[model samples]
Target: MNQESNNDQASAMNTEQVSDQSLSRRLKLALGLSLFAVMAVILLWLSSIKNIQNLEHDLAIKLDTFNEKNMQSLALAKNADTRSAEIAARAEILEEKYTESFDQQAALKALYQELANNREERMLSDVEQLLVIANQQLQLAGNIKPALLALQAADTRLQGFDSQKAVQLRKSINQDIQRLQNLPLADLTSISLKLGNLSQRVDQLALVSDRHPNSAQNKIAPDTSNNPWRKLTQEIWQDIKGMIRIERIDRPELPLLTQEQTFFLRENIKLHLLTARIALLRHDEVTYKSDLAAAQSAISLHFDGRESLTQNTLLEIKALTSNHISTELPDIEQSLRLLNLYKLSFVPALAREPKSKRLP
Candidate 1:
């Protein structure tokens, strides 16, 4: 019985120990699982905190970027607004210029049309009038230069027309011009001015005298001695000589002029010079020659002929009188006649045309 109890106790103790070891192992496993859960929870909380911080930082950066982009967009928008206003102003200026240009173009067109309307007839009339004026100048004024100019103007007008019909007229006008060009023209103005100068010098001419006498000086009476009787004798002889004396003059005698006659002579000379100037200006060949001759004769007779100035003036006057004042100039009658015929033919044909076919 004792042995059986001991064995039974041993078995019981082994079973109890096995059961405690199993329970301890289960407690150890549960503690290890709790430690792992606590560590996982701490790790997951740290990761979550870090993720929150990253999200906040990212949000701040995005906000800053958005603000910067928004500010730049605002500035660009403002610049766009300013540029748009400037463009509007420029467009308005351009529009005004366009309007002014259009108006000027319209005025130019009207002016061109008006000019075209009367261009042909007016040109022909101008040419005809020029030819007439040239003829008149040649005939009336004897102005070769102006007549040539008028003829040249007519020729240029004909050439501007570039018509075959104007060829004969141009040829006639050219011939007239050449003829006028070949003629020598006297400088009447210079001659007239010279005459006027001579007239002014008439007052300075010295009067001529037929004879000049040598001046006699009285000799001092021979020293009259203090002798009263001798002085009385000399005085008595002088009184006898003074009462009746006959002196012989060596020079030819000339009649003395009264002051009034001298004045009248000078006035007559001036009058002649003035009359000669007038005749010269009038281009009166007959009166010019006669008056100049009379003036020369008067100057030679009254003025001192030996004076160098007088001799030179007389020579110049003689030279001027030798020139022919009147000259025959070739006329532009041929050109005038040709222009009239052209006008008669051209104007009649233009008049016969229908109104619709006319320029205007």
Candidate 2:
């Protein structure tokens, strides 16, 4: 019986030891599970921390990008505003230039209209003035060439007006010009000049003397002896000879004149020549002819005709006296009358119009 109890105690000890080993194993498993859970929680917490850090970094980058984009947009907006301002300034300048150009065009149009409105009256006034000048040239100066030129200018000016009223006036002017051209014109100026020259040469005429054939001859007394006693003896001899002189002179007998009479004769001749010149200028044919004849007679009677100058003067006087003077000159008044009539007719029409429509 004691041997059996000891064997049973050994079996009980083995069962308790097995049960403590199981309990230790269970504690070890619980510890291992607790470590695993702690490890998992730490890992999750680390992952969350890393994720938060990444999110924070991404948010910072987005903020930086947003700030940069905002800066770029602001720069773009500023540039756009500057460009808009420049465009507005340029538009203002263009508008000012357009307005100035429009004003200039308006002024030019007004000036053109004013010139067009007064063109006819101004042309008419020019025609009238030219006609007046032409009339004066014809009547006063007797200048056919200048008068014709003025008339042609007037006609040309009338042509610019293209008026039918000017036809009769132009025709009258042309007729007057033709008549003037057909009229005989005396060269009175040339004749008067020749007469004046002849008058000047009257003083140079050589006086004629009957005592000498070609020149003046003065009778000289015979020479006496040079010695005083011989001169006395010669005088006594001449007294004894009865102071007789036997000279055979073949000179023609001429009326003797004193110095006063000779001076009067030359002055009378010059006076006649001057009178002839006056008559020539007066266009008096009868008076000029008579005066020149009287001068010729006086020169032939008192002066030597053999001189070349005297002969030339006589020939020129004869040539001048031969030209006949015509009392009739063509009437240049026809054109003037026509111009006056045209003015009279046109003046009433011009006067009936308003003062602003009249010629300036």
Candidate 3:
């Protein structure tokens, strides 16, 4: 019995030992598996940490590059702003210069226009003055030659202009000049010279009472025999012949005048001639003829008609009386009217002309 009990106990113990060994093996295997899983997790954590460090370094470099690019952009933007400001200032200056240039051009154009107008006005004034002189010469002075010259000069002055009114005015002036040229010139200078020569010959004129009978028979022939009785007898006969002169008077009784009376008569004749000369110069035909006739009648009645000098004076007086001193003169009214018309219409014609057609 005892043996059986000990053997049974030993067998149980062996079984318990086997069971303990199996449990320990199972625990050790589970612990080994848990340790291997923990190691793998640690290795994965280490690898993830290294990758995170590399990513941090890359991000820093990228941040620095971005900062540099931002600075360059700011600098470029600043430079662009500066350039825009300068361009704006230059544009303002260019605009001011353009405005000044335009103003200067406008001023120059105005000055040129004013100068042209003044030139035209001056030319018209000169023509008007010439016309006035011509009118005065014709109307007041009665001088055809001077008036004709003045009209010709005015026409020549207007010849430079091409305007229609100027042409018409020139035509009128030329007509006036032609009319004056056709008129007969008076020979006043020749007539006046003849009258002066006649007045100088007045002192030498012989009077009717100045004539004397023949005294040749009263002179005794002075021979070498000196006869006193014959000389006495000849002187007595000469006195008798002188006292009773047989002369046939052709006209009425001659007026016996003293030296003073003869001088006064000659002065009266000269006064008549002087009056005739004044009348001729004054263009008074009636007065000139009447005074000349009076002078001629006085010379014939007071002076000896048979004397050659007296006959010559009478013939000259007759020639002077036949001359016509005064005549109708042509008026310059047509030319003056045309000039006034041109002056009045000048402004309108200038206005109607185109800018391109206006005289420079």
lDDT by residue for model 1 (1-360), tens? 878898899888889999999999999999999999999999999999999999999999999999999999999999999999999999999999999999999999998977864686687789988888888777776666677898888878877665555788888888888888877766777777877787778777766753332223222375557898888877777666556645448855445667687778767766766776676555567877787788788788777776777888788789878867666778777777777776676456778788999966
User: What is the model-wide C-alpha lDDT for candidate 3?
Assistant: 0.83
Superposed model 3: Cα runs more than 4 Å off: 1-123, 212-246, 345-360
Clashes of 2: 0
Candidate that scores best on TM-score = 3
Q: Between which residue pairs do clashes occur in model 3?
A: none
Query: Alpha carbon lDDT of residue 261, candidate 2?
Result: 82
TM-score sort, best first: 3, 1, 2
Instruction: Point out the higher-scoring one by lDDT: 1 or 2.
Output: 1
Q: Ranking under lDDT, best-scoring first?
A: 3, 1, 2
List candidate 1 stretches off by more than 4 Å. 1-117, 120-129, 156-159, 210-283, 345-360
- Please name the candidate that would achieve the greatest lDDT relative to the true structure: 3
Better of 1 and 3 by lDDT: 3
Error of 2 at 217 (Å): 15
The residue-level lDDT of candidate 2 at 45 comes to 94
Give the root-mean-square deviation of each candidate in angstroms.
Answer: 10.3, 11.2, 16.7
User: What TM-score would each prediction reach against the true structure?
Assistant: 0.49, 0.49, 0.54
Task: Give the clashing residue pairs of candidate 1, or none.
Answer: none
For model 2, residues 135-174, the per-residue Cα lDDT tens digits are 6755555545565677677767666444555677677767
